[model samples]
Target chain A: MVTSRDIAQRAGVSQATVSRVLQGNSRVAPDTRERVLAAMRATDYRPHAAARAMKTRRSQTIGVVIADITNPFYPELLEAVSHALDQSGQRMILWNSAGPGEYSALQAIREGSVDGLLFTTVTEGAAPLTEALVHEEPVVLLHRGLEEAQCDQVVSDNVAGGSIVADYLVRAGHEHIGYLQGPELPSTAVHRERGFRRRLHQLGMDLRPELVGRAGFQHDTARTLIRSMLHEPVPPTAVFCANDLAAFGAIDGARSLGVHVPEDLWVVGYDDIAMAAWDSFNLTSVRQPIADLAHTAVQLLLERITDPDLPVRHELFTNSLTVRGSTAHTPLDPPAEQRDSHADD
Target chain B: MVTSRDIAQRAGVSQATVSRVLQGNSRVAPDTRERVLAAMRATDYRPHAAARAMKTRRSQTIGVVIADITNPFYPELLEAVSHALDQSGQRMILWNSAGPGEYSALQAIREGSVDGLLFTTVTEGAAPLTEALVHEEPVVLLHRGLEEAQCDQVVSDNVAGGSIVADYLVRAGHEHIGYLQGPELPSTAVHRERGFRRRLHQLGMDLRPELVGRAGFQHDTARTLIRSMLHEPVPPTAVFCANDLAAFGAIDGARSLGVHVPEDLWVVGYDDIAMAAWDSFNLTSVRQPIADLAHTAVQLLLERITDPDLPVRHELFTNSLTVRGSTAHTPLDPPAEQRDSHADD
Candidate 1:
């Protein structure tokens, strides 16, 4: 069993340099890398990382459970996590929990194939996650979270974000603002909704129950529901979506009904994803520190792995509002019109 | 061990029905599910899936090697592959081979952690992949290709897609059309370049040396390079990007220089990702049958897993050009102007 120290001693290089060479980090000088390789060959020493796994049950792999891989946000998050894991010489296995493969997903953990699990999505009352808690799984929640779970969590301030949007819409003179709520199971939705409602109350206004819709977190669903909701006699003058995808849906839905965004109905979303900056959507959104959140989650996961009995930790990343064309109150645009269902996309 | 046959017999259902029930496929009736579980408990039969895996040395997991996971196209392809794998009861481990992490990525198979590997990006001179081939790794290529490789491959007709773009641009009366190619290592870039040039040659016009650039396949890179290219004495009237992301870059680049798309410079791209349809880009692109390609790749990998000695296979999927505002040739637009780099995003 050759170790980093043995390789370093044989090559006359530092242990960190030898480890970097093993991980294929490109910072090592070419000549130094050759020396390390020559030493490894001369010593007839195989790294045999798998052998250590047999003794310690560390697979050097982590399983990530994402809610929806199709969403651009999850892929971006996965990319960041993958790069971080690669830096630490670890592999990633993705499990799409949106599918009907929950049994096999849990089995992967129970079989000890992965060292730990990084959950990107865990909603409130996630009964399936109880199995992970029962066995005291090495799990860390990412951006999405579970309020009651006894696990390390790293999340952005959704309440503050929602409040910011609420204040922005009210200041823009939107009295009948609607809310496109994410599914209530996730803490993001619950907290954001609370913040929005609390801000409205502070402004001496109340969010009408009929103006809110707690539907699944999806684009097409949000589009369809928003279109139908807009058909009502007194539609909302503004809409606040819990996430960027929903905001896109709301804008598209409003367009389908011949309603102008910002001019007729203001639209805002949280999580200023890259698409928000595009000239088309130009959605005013709350930007979460995705990179910081992901990096912190990785650090927390590694800490818990080093000490199993470590107390749980909760981290909250701050958020900022990105003002764009979506929420701009322009008076030059025409007034809102009734539904134009015959228009083609 | 509880086999599907025994479960079927005890539950008074077909073997396929019992298997479907175990897979949690919703097609099974409630009564049938109840009967199967009741029978399993009465017979004290447990599905020893892990025991079977131990005997067969099968981890029931496959590795997918992708060039860039952050790219939107890769995630959609991954989602389709995951669903396909789930239908066949296989798991996917992703390998982002974009950076210097190629060594450990291939080692996963060298040590037999995964049953097989599905490569989504294997360039012409990929030395690391040859090592996997030396060990007779069960590998299948998907979407992207290698000019010469001894593995099952699934690729779209990129050459034809390029030819279509060329003919469309030529028919639209554009002679000085530039080509925004991907990195030359992958066969996709090679074949697409060939197809585009061949079509141009058929029209008695070849791609000028000065009109072609092999810049890296990325949005920001394409934008910067295209911006610099547009400043030449005779800028191209149209451009064909290797991928949609590059087309977006071209559009944003052109916009940055106050050049209008379709009116000033027609732009077409490959891989009609969902973003192409957004009102911001409205890009015309070649739509690859990603679902079919992914399904075929999974099938090929599974077949290879069952019989590693099977003869090498190559598959090509047909693609169609999706025309949108980007290629509509709307002349009622402003002409190109000098760039204002100082303008903020």
Candidate 2:
């Protein structure tokens, strides 16, 4: 409840002097500033955020909009982003947009609660919101990108990541392959699918639409879809999942069906989350530089916030393939000899 | 920038009338209210949060203190809490306490940015903070309980859950059982250890301290601890993990040692997270009833926020055991042999 006036009265100084001292203007005399600061401490005075905002036109805060925090991927990204922001002494306000409506991002921006916005749009139909935000505030898109909107973006090369999976499967001699796509709304999914299909066509492999399933970026949904896919009369020889979580579900589903991995059906996933490294699910995946993506996104956001007139920048990081036991296949040249060798061992 | 005065001038009403109309006071005439609202809309008048806070003495916002949003468990809890608060039209301000600092929780409350605080303390030594916040604002503890602090809390029956694991292991004829403990700061861990130890003693089993491993409630840390334990001269036949995440690590550790589950060693985990049912893990765990825990915590927080005079409430929910392949063992007695009447197929 203590105000600047209380500090001013106790320090025997004018209200303007007290304000200058609290703001660290450096224009105030050192002795006077110290007196005011002492009085402020004595009175337990706290500056009102709104008053500070009105004077400086800066909140020193950024809003992070995530689709769902429960998803392991977002949390990892968030931690990186938070650390980056903390280094610059800025605070982050988290906004959850997983609800039924789609206007939380817009609502937060319109309220002018933060100096900038970091949007991780997981679903489609966020074009309007992104467009509106680009016009109103500085925004950096992370993980997911918007095709129709022009804004700063930092994302992993999902297209290349998808192709990496295709290349691996082709080299491993898997002609019959299945694909699991994420939600149709997110641009990441679209890009990955495009790259995956294009590579398959280039390799002269048939792309079966019936073999592909849409899981909407959830583990349980992916599980159900995978269960149905694997139950088909002619299952694909290999399955490439959209993400690690979905791949995990596919792996588990295949195991439940009494199908041996790699031998019966090779499974490859993307993202290469921490769980992918666990011995139980030594998943072969495409690893995205998540920490780098997060750092780039925050850096771009900070630059835009500091200089709004600067041109929008887009930074893309490449993904790499991590080969593990899940994708190990018997060499085709001596398949029978290899089988005999294993039997002899 | 347009203030209520501008709207008053446009609507041909006094500033007092404009205030009444804006606040929707019953005393304001309908026609007058409509006129003021129209004028405000035309001018695009926006209420400054600070001025509104000064007048109404409420921010309609709550602060959520989470240890780590990167943790899958906390994010799930956060999503539930956010949804519950959103239903009441309250916004959440997230403070990630996973950073290297001990006073983040206290600093957040001292700043008085939110109407109430929801604390999820992952470590011990939060007594000073809990004490400081008790007098200043409404604070609710979620998932983790503080025994010395008198505040509204909602926690699952960890002790009972732990006992359930011990009893199940004993019933399965496991003579040597290992305990994997999480960080010692949290009351949940303490209670789980107490229950497990008490049940083991009651069942006439040796509670070996050497078999107990301590991890910081993380998968990697748990994996390291379990790996070292497994390398011992004589490993326990079964291990009771503190949580599902840690349990996954234990499973991974055992798998790396070429030890088949259930056949070679039994593993039972607490908190039956979604991953527990995965074929790779198939972990037997005590279900924490997360949905119920979330609902109870939110309800208690809301009650305290609405009526500070209400007595402090501590609610506990019971947990149930979820038996899966990880804990499958031979029964003490075999089924009747059918008088050797049935022949081999």
Candidate 3:
């Protein structure tokens, strides 16, 4: 069988360069790419990458499992990952794990169709994750992570992000504040909430249980939860959401009840997604370096794929707060009429 | 070699049921699923689906190529496609063709990694697409079509959608109108612009060259273009954007220039993305039934994959106009103050 080595020798190029030319990758210089193609044609060397995979057990493909594709955050992360993989001459196959697609991605790994798996969102102790780990397939976690799993992980400082929001809200003179919690499955939610509660406690403040609402990382759920919270006898003057999507929901829900944001109820969110900058939302959020996180995670996965025995690496990226119109105004007490009307409800 | 057929015979089930169980598909009944698994265990059958594919040449994977994954419209469309593929127990491998990912997807097809290809966006008569067709591959085009291609296609009524927007604007008493056009490569842009121009002509109106701006379905590009258009000697009272993303940019741009929508100008968008309903935007847009379109497109691709000789199918879905705050107010003449300000420029 003719191999890339033979083509490389014929074209006077390295084996890696030959592989890049085979991928139709643009990184190859024009003259070198022509030489490789001419060599392949002259030798009648058929390009059957799948057939080669059976011999070498490498498919040059990676499987990416995302929580929800429609979520703006995932797409931004996915785009970054896609570009990084393209630079390395690898293909990406996606699975929307929010549905039944997770198992399919696992099956792809078992069938030797992908070199490794990169999970952007995964539940701790998921069966599929455990199965992949037991088999020693290359795995890397990004953004949302599992603490118990022994794999390469890339995460932003969620705890610090949460603490910063709490400090900002308190210093802005929000005497009464609410919290919108994300689902408890992922570490992101757990750490963010932990830091927020811890910081509030240190400051001699209490987050009354009645003022806290729990929801998945979704807009509609947060909206509904905030609406009910606003009806409490002593409603909160501010609300901090676990993520940007929930913050949008909270703002919309508050608007539906005729409550003005920042003036009546300040809102802050995490993950500075692009929509946060839109004139509609202008949401104050904690910004994670998504492009940096994505690129580093892919690099880690590739490193593990090449050397499975290397030491496990956990990368923690720092976070910053982006203050926008949502939390730009100083806190104001709820109007007497609004507070009295809530008592009627 | 222990085949699923052998397990089916022992379990008193059909071969299809065994295949479903092996795939971990949820469509099988609980009792039937248990019996199938037991039979496989009793026979000591190891699941090597890749080995089976080597024989049957069927991987049960589909390649999905999308243009610009960050665009809200693509994700909405992708979620629908992911759900449809999940139901059929087929894996979806995604490629963002906005970069160099398209060639990677074609390579997958060449290596028999995917059973067929589904294109959500493509330029007319592209080289890679032509290569796929030449190889007798099962290919389907969704939302974009090529007149010279012989593959199955699924698209919405872009021409009618454009006409509807033109009629709505004309009826709103707007004398001067503008158009924010999409890229010239895709059929969606061409047909939409053609329909809008034709309708305007029938209504005894003309779309002057100075009143039109072309961009590649992006927010920032449209924003820059609209800022310049607003400086024209006779600016438009209403602007019809090719897609919702452009409308957002147009609205943001006009606001930056102190031009209030509907009072000084009206903005309309297409694709009715989820963001369109946000209170910040509340943009009037043309709504295409994305779920229906995605499901039908997948069905066509699967049918072609199954038979390879089925008659070519082209499905066209209809679109509707969603009126919202962006165009809700009465069209006022470009205020005298605004016109005077532009003249000073």
Candidate 4:
């Protein structure tokens, strides 16, 4: 039941100034805007988003298109995005793409449905969808980016993450290594593959074409692929999976083949999901700034919403290596370091 | 560009009938409504929710407030809810409560935001939230229900789920058992604990005070609590964790104390999250019909939204035991049988 006048009184600002801030006017001073935001937070004043949207022609809702909600990675990303959006008085309308073909993103982003769009599922062939989406609303690419789209983008440094894994695995003395990847469509997978190969090439090594397999972003598919690869006479002594889920599958496939992780075979994964540190998997993986990536995406989207004339911006977040039992020579990741990387961690 | 006319033609109905169905008018016949829904899905007809809300004062956006989206259980629940809502031509605005005290649900449910709410994180003593939410909106409790709130609710049979675990462990011949529970606020914990203790009493056994611990629904907290329990002079031969994350923690705690899962100590968890079937954890868990629960909750909410005068209803879904490697005797779960439990599983 709190009102803007009450917040204005508490923040020592005029009611008109508070209204201006609520409307996302660019003329307000930074300090004044900060005070108004602080007062709103202190008083728990929700400014009737739908009412405001009706008046301003903005819905105060962000359309979030996720490839799969059940994937642990997307959930983690969403947790951060939700927290950030809540602070700014924006609501998130979530759309799970279900699978590649199960959803129509173009139809979903109809006019006035949301203030903007944050997409986490921009795979390779998604250019047409993004192309159509850009003409309709302000769109921000999150986690996944499209080369063909000229929109604001925030993503993890997949290439660097891949390189970190390659560096760690090579340092651990693994020569015969394999690379397991997700679908070729996802830029995340492509960039990760690029980084891993780029680093291996720098280290005077290469993953032969026959040693790479694609799992189509499925855990079971990854397991089947790894099982076949491990059954060969000249199998890989180490493997680097595009993501942690694939890495878990590789471990299971290795176990079924009577090979122990970090002993007879070493495995590395990307995206370092929460399960990586569990006593069960103890997967060695690359840690992306999930919270930062989400926060930056939301922040950039808001800026674009506030000022449509702003030039398109792309932000890339760095990633670090989290070493665990999955690798032969990597030490166990301590809890304190993980906590230090992200505030939400 | 799929339109009401397209859906109407596909359903063999007039455009007026399709419009009536989209508006959620109670005059539409059930079979006609179903046909309209099917046609809409087939043709990928996505109604502009905001534009519709402006015209009809009924937003097709359901506000979903969850406790912690990072928890695999919640993400799984959200996946089901999103899928069901999509089929019904509605959108989901996700609000991750983050944790206790970080959000106020009643405040978040402003009048103009969403037509209904689907709450997945209702703990005991949340009377104030539901009390305010019910008067302002058509709210349906999903996964968690409040005893004090007169709202439509769909939840798992936690009492029966707890009883199933007791029955299975007793049949497996484990006498010394411990129970690891989530926070006291959640009704699920209370109901689960009640059923577990009741079954133990029926078997002429009881859990001592020292054998019970609360994890506050956190993985690390569970690990610490289980570690202390395991270090006792005489530890339990089996432990029943309220959820899979806690069960994973129990396994880790036991391993730290030189005890092995399914050999020296047995662990059973609830919710049967996707991780339970992984080659790593393979936790034996009670599987709730998550998809059915979500679908039913949305259907109930829609019914209530169409006719707010209807009597409030409650649905309790039965959960089945999914046997996997975490137990001492149960074999690994096969994927085909995994889908046989639920119709849409």
Predicted structure with the largest lDDT when compared to the true one: 3
Candidate 1 chain B superposition, TM-score: 0.83
TM-score of every model versus the real structure: 0.81, 0.81, 0.85, 0.87
In model 4, what is the error at residue A247, expressed in angstroms? 1.0
The 10-residue segment with the lowest total lDDT in model 1 chain A:
A336-345
lDDT string for model 4 (A54-135, tens) is 6677766677888787778888888888877866667677777734322443444555656777888877666545565556
**Which regions in candidate 4 have their CA more than 4 angstroms from the true location?**
A1-17, A23-30, A37-51, A98-113, A127-129, A132-136, A330-345, B1-16, B24-31, B34-51, B98-110, B133-136, B330-345
Which model is ahead, 3 or 4, in terms of lDDT? 3
Task: Considering only chain B, report the TM-score of each candidate against the true chain B.
Answer: 0.83, 0.77, 0.85, 0.84
* DockQ, every prediction: 0.33, 0.49, 0.51, 0.52
The runs of at least 3 residues in candidate 3 whose Cα sits more than 4 Å from the true structure, single-residue gaps closed, are A1-3, A6-47, A230-235, A329-345, B1-3, B6-47, B229-235, B257-259, B262-264, B329-345
A131 Cα displacement, candidate 3 (Å): 2.1
Candidate ranking (lDDT, best to worst) = 3, 1, 4, 2
Worst 10 residues of 4 chain B by lDDT: B336-345
Candidate 2 chain B weakest ten by summed lDDT: B336-345
Task: Please give the distance, in angstroms, between residue A341's alpha carbon in candidate 4 and its true position after superposition.
Answer: 34
Error of 4 at B244 (Å): 1.0
The residue-by-residue lDDT of candidate 2 on A1-345, one tens digit each, is 887778889999999787555433444677887898789778887676567657756565677888877768788888888887765546677887743323554455555556777888645566545565646577788988876567888988899888777776776666568988888878788888888888888888767877888976677777777778778887777898888888888888888888888677778888888788888778888888988998788778777865677787888899998878787742223245433533332
Sequence-dependent TM-score of model 4:
0.87
Q: CA lDDT of A4 in candidate 3?
A: 89
Q: What digit string (tens of lDDT, one per residue) describes model 2 on residues B1-345?
A: 898789899999999887655433445677888898889889998776557656745555667777766656778788888777665555677778643322443454444446666777644566545455556467777888876677888888888888877777777666667888977778888989889989889988867877888865677877787788777787777899888888888888888889888776778887787778888999988888777777667666656655678898888889988888887743333123421211110
